[model samples]
Target: MNLDPPISSSEVTLERLDPLSAAAARPVTTGAALLALVLPPLTLLSRGHEVTQPLWLIVSYAALGGAAWLLLDRSRSTRPVWTAPSAQVFQVLLMVMLVTAAAATAGANDLVRDDWAPLVVGVLLVASTPYRPAREILFWTIVHTLLCAALGVIQAPSAITDVPALTLAVTGSFSIAVMGFAAAAYARSLTSSTQLWHDRAWQSAAAAALEHRSGVARSVQQRRVSLLNREVVPYLQRVVNADGIGDDDREEARRLARSIRTLLVSDVEKTWAQLMLDDLVGRHPRLNITAVADDPDDLGRRAVLERRTLLRALAAISVERLSATGLALRLSTPEGRLAVRWEVATPRPLPDAHRELRSMLELIRGLTLRSSVHELPGRLVIEFEYGY
Candidate 1:
């Protein structure tokens, strides 16, 4: 078997858009969206403090809601194209705005800030893990940490003087950064492992198929060698052993030469249509198998296999159920499509002939782009159209 052509860049991109990866990434995005939705309200309720700047708090909640909506919208898309770098940058900017808003809300009110917004920002970073590179993740994580810290310093300068408050701001932002890095690392590792397994499985299957084909070729070669020894070699040996040339020996030699010529010609590759007709006529000596073709060499390997399978099924039906003594195969290529028409004559209709034909036709339908089976009073016709 020949190896397929090298994959194009577009093909590689399409493969990267695996539905499994999209499915796995969706849950992470959805979870981040949910956290974004739930965490701010929880923080407000727990703090039990009046929001001095209600409008800023509203803006903060609106930003968080917008981020959540964006992520949820991307998750809904089949391919999840939001994992691109530009999209990630836009999302991270939104997260930064949300953090700044939260810090402003803390500054306006004398509330003990819990750093929930920064933590949620860290969680939102996981949404890009499936598509973005590790360096990109690391870069965004550092950017987010610095942005959160700067917002904290600007919004709550008094709180920064207290040791515990200072510790909370620094540690909280760095801890979130650590979590983001860990999530990105894990996602990358999982993707690598899954791809590795898929490649190994494909290679294993290809090797097994190649081995099976080699075995079949060896078997065919052995049979051909045995046939030559039995039919041609012995006659030649007898002629050589004889003391003198005779008319009888010459006649025998002529017959042997014809046999060898026929064998050699038959060994040449023939179109599937020709091969099937020869095989069917040989198996059923009384049966008439006619094959007509135009440009049979244009047929692809897959088309040939499909034609052979259909012929085998028809042959089996003729042998087992219908006493069909005649069959015709017409193969033609028109407008880049390969079309095959098969006609078989039935002497008398069997009780289950139509049912069996329908079943066989149904199986053949999968092998071709278009196929149809028709039954007349005493004949069945199958037409198949396929592409290279």
Candidate 2:
């Protein structure tokens, strides 16, 4: 009876999704890296002859930070994630750079006040927040803070300072705390919100999928009962009430069994697309996305099964970020290439939808085309040809 609606599916999470990934934050990393390159040289330039071992300090601190920035940024793009081991190594390198800057100073400048290493290292920590967890960032921040304080204390004893070494310690590394803790807090809050959304959305989607499958089974069973009631069940009852079964009854039973068999076989022969639609319909409990396959020219073996993951990613992002009312995708080959038309419906216009999708668009550049964002009130229609 419920032949009108089919189903669809989507999957997206903030951590790995292109929106919030380390790769997407390359500009931030690059800016921090640039600052590292500039700050130490500026310290030497400003202090003129007062700063000690200019070549040594700038080379060690600025060079290390710049190299770390390059390495971390590249890793994010090349891999699924910047591994925790790699991040740990990178943070260790940062602390070593700070210690080197302090040693190279030789107490000519206040190791705490005049050194560029502490401030740049703090910026680097903020940049690393995208790649590393909050706990790890905070832990490393504490480590860096202590290291700065120790350097300041060692320098304080030999020099003329009105402030106590402990007080100097707090002043010297306080910026690191402010910057690193702030970045860690941001990462923590974002992670929690994303995790909560991911959990709730998946839970609701799973429940919807289960309900849809159960409904389909019940529908099939109801149809079977309807068929059996017409002649097969009544005929069996009469035969039981009568003395012996006749040739006519035997023929009728065989015909009924054949009809049921044919029906089941036909049901089994449906295309992959139809089956996918059936399973995916009502899967998103949020909007209850109902799929209706308009594949009059049906040739379905996933219609480019390699692109299923892409579709899933796009769908997930659309729902999570765009507040999508519904999602529709069409996969077809035109001019010997796969043509995809993806449409997301929202209750209101998302002016920055394209901007939000910048990273994902890059991932599938071949499938992006300029279209009606301003003109379309409640829909985003993306039509493109994808060769890869």
Residue-by-residue lDDT tens digits, candidate 2, 112-159? 565677887788878766556677777888998888888788777654
RMSD after CA superposition, every candidate: 12.9, 11.9
Local distance difference test, candidate 1:
0.58
Prediction 2 global C-alpha lDDT:
0.63
Q: Give the lowest summed-lDDT range of ten residues in model 1.
A: 6-15
lDDT of candidates 1 onward, in order: 0.58, 0.63
Off by over 4 Å in 2: 1-14, 17-24, 70-76, 160-163, 214-388
The alpha-carbon deviation from the true structure for residue 295 of candidate 2, after best TM-score superposition, in angstroms, is 25
What does candidate 1's lDDT look like per residue over 237-317, in tens digits?
A: 886898888998888778877876776675465554555455456566675544333335635334533344556566667
Candidate 1 is scored at a TM of: 0.48
